[model samples]
Target: MSDSTDLPRFPQESSPGPTGPTGPTGPTGAAPTRPGTVNGAFWAFLAATVISIVSGLLVLGERDSLADAVRRSDAKLTAQQIDQAATVAMVAAVVIAVLIALLYLLFAVKLRAGRNWARIVLTVLTALQVLSLLAGSGGSWIGYLSCLAAVIGVVLSFLPESSAYFAAARPVRR
Candidate 1:
């Protein structure tokens, strides 16, 4: 008689068969839902960044006005000095605008990731922006629009839906 050991294991010895239903499945968590506020904030920040870049370009375009303003503020400044200062200011503004745009993007990403600190930081920055806009003499429409976008972003971040998402993301205490 053939020994049982001569035969391969049941499944291993058999030819491939039709696949059957798998075993019990693990719990699947609820589907992730991105809040509208987060999306709004992201777009608003992007808009603000574009507006800031445009405003910087506008400043460069009106270099003569900037130099004149500087001269009026400081009578001792010669034409050459005023021109130099205007150039410096334009360069500085461009650099600052780029940096601000990058900062806004970072904040938007962090905020979307449910970072409470990012939300707080963005709110503080928005408040500072609004304050600065209020304190300074207004210029181009771009500046006002940028400030408005910042304000909208801040508001959206504090909406009830946003708050709920943040709360959900927060770790629960024992």
Candidate 2:
């Protein structure tokens, strides 16, 4: 057998040299960067959340009309019952709006983090909103505007740059 000194050694075995640099590395790249489309989507979601809250407030503001309509449809309802029903309806509307706004914010944060699942979920939600807008006729302008904002957010999320960023952010398989 040849002497150990005659054998060629690999670079790693030769020495414990200093590494070039140290930094964080995710499945994606060195660092995450926010694309313009993502920024637009974030703002759109925020606007949609605000619009939903305002719409709920408007519904609350029209409590009298709601109670009158309810009373007209059901003549047997006493004044106290009518008032309770209107208050319950307004409270339910406000709660639902708050929940939806919270969901929008959650999606915005996840999307900003380059989560592909969040993008898909937001897209699906936007589609549902569009369908609801098309099927309903009694929605106020605020509802329509919120739908428009959702559409814009979805559109921006699907832009070419956004797509590329999401692709780059995908988890790398070992």
* Top-scoring candidate (lDDT): 2
Judged by whole-model lDDT over C-alpha atoms, candidate 1 comes out at 0.76
Candidate 1: give the clashing pairs.
Answer: none
Badly placed stretches (over 4 Å) of model 1 are: 1-32, 75-78, 172-174
| Cα lDDT tens digits for candidate 2, 1-174 | 889999887776443222222223353335445679988987887888888889888887899999999999999999999999999999998899889889988988888887888889989988988888889767788899998998899999899878766765653222
Off by over 4 Å in 2: 1-29, 172-174
TM-score of 2: 0.82
Candidate-wise lDDT, in order: 0.76, 0.80
